[model samples]
Target chain A: EAGVAQSPRYKIIEKRQSVAFWCNPISGHATLYWYQQILGQGPKLLIQFQNNGVVDDSQLPKDRFSAERLKGVDSTLKIQPAKLEDSAVYLCASSPAQSLHFGNGTRLTVT
Target chain B: AQSVAQPEDQVNVAEGNPLTVKCTYSVSGNPYLFWYVQYPNRGLQFLLKYITGDNLVKGSYGFEAEFNKSQTSFHLKKPSALVSDSALYFCAVRDGVNQGGKLIFGQGTELSVKP
Candidate 1:
């Protein structure tokens, strides 16, 4: 089975720039998630979607970060006017049952 | 609030010796614990999970964990360690009730197996 797919394996941008990350969850998976992993830290949940509906995004910084799941299939997470602290890896995962399968992730380096 | 803790930042052992990585968690409802391993520059890979069955659960790559409800701990263990077993291991707990079964992860523990 194909694992969750994410694009732009690496991205480098200056502070105050806008950047977006894309995720394509595994087929037939209803639960999709976005997480941010800083160096030396475990991944932290940014948002979760169940069948195209947002289930939880309380940790998402709505002021600068936004995400959307289209047709319950793929998702996109965006950071506008990114900050220096936004340098980290963005991981996308999908769950068909209890546990989640993750993609390689996109590493964002904010200068 | 549900949370998991990996008290150790790193664990080191020689190959052919037994290895243990400690984890503890606190949550309401079923503990629904899990262990995942992540290699550098790669995503997390599921190693095992503890839902409701036996206190001792076996998983991939010759890994196993004993779930102790009395102590609220789930520790990953391997009878014989291999150099290939080195990676960053994360302990997570599934929130059985709220936030759509969110998985909360600990800071992660790095394991180094020297041959």
Candidate 2:
């Protein structure tokens, strides 16, 4: 029973640069999610996917943030021209049932 | 709109003593409540969930939560705290009717168990 896997545990980029975070969900999981957690705050949902199709992304910033889950097993979240305010931890979670299992997350530091 | 509230920003308890972390939720119809713990630099781990049935639900790591429908509260408890129990605790809730079943999370409470 391996947990959800995320890549590049930490990332640092200058403002206006592009950064991307990748997530590989657990085996046989049908739902995947992306969340952003700022320091001292709880994680906020960015996007959610049920299989290869998106379920909800209303909170996502369409101007600069985009995400895709091509095969329904793995997903990527991309931020174009990242802003300083974007400095936060990006968490990837997967769920086979109602309960979610989270990954270690990627800490993004925007300079 | 569904929402969760963790009123305390931090809580401190001595090892071997009882510990309690407060949580409250608001949602239409029945609520699906959950508790999760997050260690420093790590992601959230599920501690417990209260969907239906018993008001008191036990979970991993000797943790338990009491769900009170009258008060609309779900508080995490431990009979004897350990230093290892220190972490950030989150309270979340989901509306029963939402198609995506997205959870609404509280701000999180930092629990410190001093040895």
Candidate 3:
């Protein structure tokens, strides 16, 4: 079986610029998640989706960040007016049950 | 709130020697623990998880973790280290009450296995 897929393995943008990352999870996987992994830190959950509805997004910066899993398949995460601090790798993962399977991730460099 | 701690920033070991990465967690109720490994520029890959049963949980890549409830610890271990095993390891935990399946992760520990 194929693993989770993501696009634009690497991205570079300037501060205040808008950027978006995409993810396509494993077929039939019910749970999808987006995480931010800053250097020297573990991945932090930014948002989670169960089917097309959001399960949790408490840590997401509503003012700057947004994500959607349309039709309960592929998903997208956007960070508008990006900040230098947002220069971290964005990871997309999915779970069939308890254990998670992650993609290669998109390395975003915001100037 | 649930939290996890990996006290060691890095650990160094020689080939054929044993290796360990320490982790501890705090939660209100029963906890579900997990271990993951990440190569440079790659996303985390699941190693093993402790839902219940025996304290020793073996995972992929010939790695294992021992869960000690009383100590609130789940330490990853490998009997013989390999240079190829050098990578970043993370420990995570999920609380029973929330059931949101949200995981709290540790800072991460870099394991360096020398040849």
Identify the candidate with maximal DockQ.
3
For candidate 3, what is the recovered fraction of reference interface contacts?
0.78
DockQ of each: 0.71, 0.74, 0.79
Cα error, candidate 2, residue A56 (Å): 0.7
Worst 10 residues of 3 chain B by lDDT: B96-105
lDDT (Cα, tens digit) per residue for candidate 2, span A11-53: 9999999999999999999999999999999899999999999
Off by over 4 Å in 3: none
Residue-by-residue lDDT tens digits, candidate 3, B1-115: 8899999999999999999999999999999999999999888999999988999999999999999999999999999999999999999999976666788889999999988
Positional deviation of A70 in candidate 3, in angstroms?
1.6
Docking class of 3: medium
| Tens-place lDDT digits, model 3, residues A1-111 | 899999989999999999999999999999999999999999999999999999999999999999998899999999998999999999999988888899999999998
In model 3, what is the error at residue A87, expressed in angstroms? Answer: 0.5
Q: How well is each residue in B17-110 modelled by candidate 2, as lDDT tens digits?
A: 9999999999997999999999999999999999889999999999999999999999999999999999999999988777357887899999
**What is the DockQ score of candidate 3, to 2 decimals?**
0.79
